[model samples]
Target: MTSISTTSSPATPTTVASAASKRVADRIAARAGDPDITLRERVALRTSDAEVTYAELSERAQKTAAELSALGVGAGDIVGVRLPSGPGAVAAMLACWHVGAAFLPMDASAPDAHRDHLLSRSAARAVIDGDGPRSLTDAAPSATGSPKGDDAYVIYTSGSTGTPKGVLVGQDAFAEHTTAIADLLELRDTDTVLQFAGLGFDVAQEEIWPTLAVGGTVAFLDSKDRALGPAELARRVRELNVSVLQLPTSYWRLLCAQMRGTESPGLSFDGVRTVVIGGEAAGTKDVHAHRDGPLGHCTLVNGYGPTETVVTCTAFVLRAHEPLPPTAGLPIGGPVGERRLYVLGADRRPAAGDSPGELWVGGSPLAEGYLNDPQRTAERFHADPFGSASGARMYRTGDLVRRHRDGTLEFLGRLDNQVKVRGYRIELDEVERHLTDTRGVTAAAAVALDDGTGTGGRILAAALAVTAGGPTAEEIREDLRGRLPSHLVPGLIRVRDALPLTTSGKIDRKAVAAVLADEHTAGEEAGAGVRVRADADAASAGIAAADTADADLTLLLKLIRTLLRAPDFGPDDDFLAHGGDSLVALRVSGTLREHGLRLRPSDLLTAQDARAAAVRMERS
Candidate 1:
């Protein structure tokens, strides 16, 4: 919340492209066989399952590259690496670079259709798994050196349309971005960076290459570790002796909540020197929780940037010396390296220092642009008017932010319908497109709402207009589940007679939100199926007392109320319809555990309504 202090002027837009851009394989291989380096003795990566050394990583990558070559992978080709987040995936990505091929990392957890689109769209030469390629061949790594302009990796993100767009980043741009990250973090060989983000995400580039570029250890969290509770995450941090940790703002808050008491509960912040939180707007509640708590000993940094900008183009480091400002939003800070950020008004002119406007980022770290889509590339990437380099471009970030007189930039919201849910960028129009694709759906619209209370504060809600014989909401949801990733699937679906329209005949989103809110309020007042207190029952308010016959139901209702912070939701009203998400469901499960009751989060999710959830609890 405190304003970021700046000492340097805004960096120039010109990026001195590396004369010989270093490839991932070349940089990591630098220390591989060096007698003085002894990479075999240094731990390169650690996961919940096992630890791998730098020498072992290099050998594996080389072998994988050979296998890929046999599969027809060549210079300037794209190879799809569909593997989970870990050392194996990292090795495969590096292997592509070694073979003079660009790699596309597809999320293994994504739906088959999503993965299929990426592989097909990229025209991949081959696919690689973590175990290695399907077979070993007599193919060899290309002897031709990689040029600075050669493609490195293509990462896909949500687009304004229904499909995801791949951002083709050049090796020079990637190298520059990673180097800046390493310098900003002051990484060292002794430092261990956690690689928790999915490989499909650009942040994984920040987590892996930056650490490896400095000869630092890259630690990965296994599937279980990724789902670790607050207590477990803190304990693991201590056990791993991790010095640097970066987590999404929401997850960081959950851990900070456990550290709020005077006595440290589970996490020991002794080894952690810096904690970088980003991916979305950070909450002041989290800052207050950690600023004076156990994490006060460590430094906290707020980073901001779009995937098109590679990683973080700007960062604000929070020090113990300065007090947090009494504000809701945190400053994104000034540009780093050769990156330059401009706040332009609606007229595309630079706004006043303190005025709100769209953020335009110009720099060398900017991506080459969307792969195979020249139209979108031109729409978003514009000529760098202030750049010294000829034909240099800048990306138009739809994010709206305000630059203060002190040069600190604070995020407001988006200029478009794009929203980030659980650190995943989502385009509402994309979701609506898919929704309308469902059979019988005449029209559809999607809206993202954030209550800023639960773990998954952002929820995608969709409204549909059907003529007749339309697929049921459940059927539509089921159809979407197969075509889209879980994160893109709307948590709530409402079927309406017709989508409310404005005077211009366009769908009125504000009207839809108002209707939803009013429905929730009316549903609460109607009581639905919620049990009422008996006339003589003075011990309980709306629910029964702890020792009552319906104690389980009472406890469940109260827990749901606390999780949603919505006292008005009736027993029959769907929890999700009232803004319950996976995070809130997890909290409900934990509360049930305290009562010696067992109810799976999945059970509650499927049940939807409180009455059904109670039934599931009774069955359990």
Candidate 2:
């Protein structure tokens, strides 16, 4: 049986051994002697604090590499990097590559235990944080024994068993993937690409490596800009002349709404030539809006791949001149570069025509495997029996997809309990495990529910079976906040005596989700009632304090109520307590800006309630 190749161009006969072996750092180094002086001196990194040119960046990387070598870091070693997203972080990564060591990216904000776990598991030789590089282990370097010598990086993703698993990507695969992405996006030396994804994510590699490999500028969003709403983000992109934008689909949907809204005066993607959206399905409405709106000239791409595939393996490019697909949802199109995608059935054969099957990704872009976990590596990465190449393996994505008649793949839902929420891949069982471990929780089931905002956004919600006289829902959420990452924490938690169960004695997740949805709807209705009463009270007062600070508080409360869909609450009420998440906060801030007010999402999140937010707005 022969494997199907889904690339638009014929699959080139390239083996993993024959893939590009030049490191991304080496590629950037080679750009120094370019005939175009402007290209040689192009801005490699742009942060709010400073802009570093390609030559300067290269010098920093060399210095950092020397520092790492002094710490006895060498080929096949893993160096843990714990730094905030900035020039320093990128330089640290390049330094690891220069020393022929694999870089293990650790989130600067991650809990100490999480960081410790990753370090212990990866057996990192050194650590780099704000204080700079320090040796973590005195042991000698462990040879990876790969033809590629060392790995480029190892990124951890959410695992089902309550622990994150690290995916090891070889340098050859990394170089090939980044080069392919640069070509696919047609990135030029003059382009400025926005570095949006977190440093810990594989998408960050895509954002940084591809642009740098092509001598393009990689713009980093500062803390303030990172929290900006869609409108503000669009304005920032325009201000920076960002020509390429890679955003999560959920945020892209919001940005699309902002572009189509009447209040967004200067919100535009005027200079953006390409916009890549992934980590979740693209909404058809947003796709059509971008096609028909002012951004009609920009190329919109829907990229699809798991972390194991080294960022993106298949991309559905919606060029401005091409006709939009008639399907309801956008297709996750053909393979990029030397990558291969197959839709195989239960028998490990190609699925019958139009039949949905599991997505299996192969070729040079596939990662080596999960770090130090052979069981998982073996289970997910299977030998490619259909391929003629010896020892070629394909990753079983566990994503249900169907190859369209036109050869593009349309994503169905996941076959497992894993879900992508707001660009973060989460495992329900992992959340459930943490929930049950919480004090006073006997059982738990976490589920993703539509946020009801009509923006194609989903929020994490959990149903818990608590002990008698256990902690309140708010208390449980507070406990979870300390344990899980912010995104993993449930926005809405429902505590009940018992959870709904199926006849097979398993937790009925669907039933729980339905019940939670009903409760959410009821809460919104009650919030509407409170809003009406608040309006009535203000109207009955007859504009007596219409021009005062009290009036501003009322307006802020109204906006908050509308965004949260919750009933009116006191000045001390918490925004997050009323089902507000970061996305909702962005919308609130953006809407408030249109009303001649300025409040960052961070400010609103920190403010106790609507009244406090209004006060903060006044101070600003």
Candidate 2 residue runs with Cα over 4 Å from true position: 1-5, 8-18, 33-39, 137-149, 261-265, 292-294, 535-547, 558-569, 576-579, 593-598, 618-620
Provide the lDDT at 493 for model 2. Answer: 85
lDDT of each: 0.73, 0.79
Provide the TM-score for each candidate, comma-separated. Answer: 0.85, 0.91
Q: Which residue pairs collide, candidate 2?
A: 527-566, 527-567
Model 2 scores worst on lDDT over the 10 consecutive residues at: 1-10
Model 1's TM-score against the true structure: 0.85
Give the per-residue lDDT digits (tens) of candidate 1, residues 481-594. 787777788766779889999999999999987776565444444432343542222233345554443567666776676455455555676775555655666667755765
The global Cα lDDT (0 to 1) of model 1 is 0.73
Give the best candidate by lDDT.
2
- Residue range with the least summed lDDT across 10 consecutive positions in model 1: 136-145
